[model samples]
Target: MSNKPTCRWWPLAMLGAILAVVVLTWFFDGLKPELRLDMRSLPPGAGHWLGTDTLGRDVWLSILAGSQRSILVSIGAALIGGSIGVGFGSVAAFFGNDRLRFTLRAYLAALLLLVVFVYSIAVLWPTVSSTGHVSVGISILLALIAFVAIFWLLLRRFNLLRSRITFPLDTITQRFIEVISVIPRLYLIVAFAMIIPINMFTLIVLFAVTSWDVMARMVRAEMLKVREMTYIESARIIGLSESKVFFRHALPNAIGPVATQVCFTISGLLIAEATLSFIGVGVSPETVSWGSIIHGYLENLQAWWLAVFPGICIYLTVISLHALGNDLDRMCHSKH
Candidate 1:
């Protein structure tokens, strides 16, 4: 009833509507020829909302399907990489023996070296067929293995925190906080690795890797600050182990900023993916991302609608994500 205009609802409302349109288009992508792209496809009138593409495919359908893939891949990358980063980061913060820190750093560096080596191979040979599938699978496996190894190290460190029975619950809670920290850079790195693979899965990983760095750094910074809090000091004084105090007392509180990052990450990754695709480094030409769509009609400057509509779609989606992140941040801080 307060007349303060609930900005919170706006993003949800817009997202819902966009999602609905995407669903409709996906469901009818092949059914109705409402926006089919053939020359016989008539101009926008009562029937077609966005007109047609060069192949007479419904512009709306193409946009919907393409957006779906982009969103799914981004979210997937965020979740996967984010979780891995958080686990290892939290462990390092909690029971961080100099040995453990050195070990993890060494492990991460080794992974980076391997990825670089593989990337060199990809750049040099660059197959354009099902080989992309193998490349993408290898990249994903490498990313996952690296993440898991780091997380395992973190888990082992957390076990040190658990020795203090007075705060056993706290040590377990570290996992969530740690995961959020790794999301930004880890996702970004995954996305970058995916870029050269020329496969759908690789494209998703590329976006993931490029986007997760910010989240991981944000989480780590928050944990660092939280580790110095009064309760944390008290927990240590009361004989609560370092791991317990670090995971239980500090982690939950640090999750506040993670939501905001998620919103920005989504929008940013979309633009990044499109840009990559435009440069011919993202998904293959057969893929229907907004970037590919734009590339398809780059020479046909007169028929600008092909590129215009997809660009608009990207803009709208990004704006909606940004607005949502802002609203979520407000909601989170308001609670604090």
Candidate 2:
């Protein structure tokens, strides 16, 4: 028999420390991130612990405020996206017939292509309408409406396909996953942002939509493996319903990978949020976020503190999340 591997502690320690900082920052909400003309662009000193931005806002206060927003958005995106991925993936793997699986795979592929096309159109909308014949806003609105309509149609079709199961697996799903895997996610985000009016909620939605495919694929892979186990077969043999066999016997065992996927998703979403903000397309200008804070100082190279403090916060938070995910993944493997 193999000896159980001992769990590492530093990941948990780092995660705890990061959470503590975030919580502490939240409690100091009284220190509002308002402007102070007298202290504008001041270096770190007795008056401002982290210095002041060009707009005279306390850097420390901004960092705290930004951290709160970033964390909330990241957590929200991760939870929503992870839930979606797990649900869709588990259903496809366990309940899907071959025809249903093929339809779903086709839908996913079409969805990817739709995203790319929409993003491209959004990016070129302004240039294409240089003659002022078409309003950019109207173009964006139409594009968004089209995206929604297509998505709804695909969903309706998926439901219809689900009603008629033909086979257990489809190679098309794997091909769809591979196609999506090769696309540049950052470019996709930037393109989407160009067409959409970005706010915190919109950013969260964007992250959730784009990031869910990976989580779904992960869950699907795990469920496929688990469903083939002897116990699952025995449960089926004993006349357990497919739903029961899936939810009760297979799903619970497959959760470890899902949990790890969620952790990593949170980190990736946070980084995506930051990148959007850095590029001036994430949150609204009025919203306080670490990415926005860093972006504000881009014009003034000497305002190093403005960028450094928030950059550090983003770095630490993402690293902590990644470390925690690694630990969770290791624990999951050890159990197997």
Cα lDDT tens digits, model 1, 272-299, are 6776666666465456667766765664
Evaluate model 2: give its TM-score: 0.74
Which ranges in model 1 have alpha carbons more than 4 Å from their true place? Answer: 1-7, 21-43, 93-196
Per-model TM-score, in order, reads: 0.66, 0.74
Worst 10 residues of 1 by lDDT: 161-170
* lDDT of model 2 at position 233: 93
lDDT of 2 by residue, 95-139 (tens): 655523345545554566667566645454434434344566567
Where model 2 places Cα greater than 4 Å from the true spot, the runs are 1-10, 13-29, 99-183
**Candidate number achieving the greatest lDDT relative to the actual structure:** 2
Q: Highest TM-score, which number? A: 2
Evaluate residue 2 in candidate 1 and report its C-alpha lDDT on the 0 to 100 scale: 60
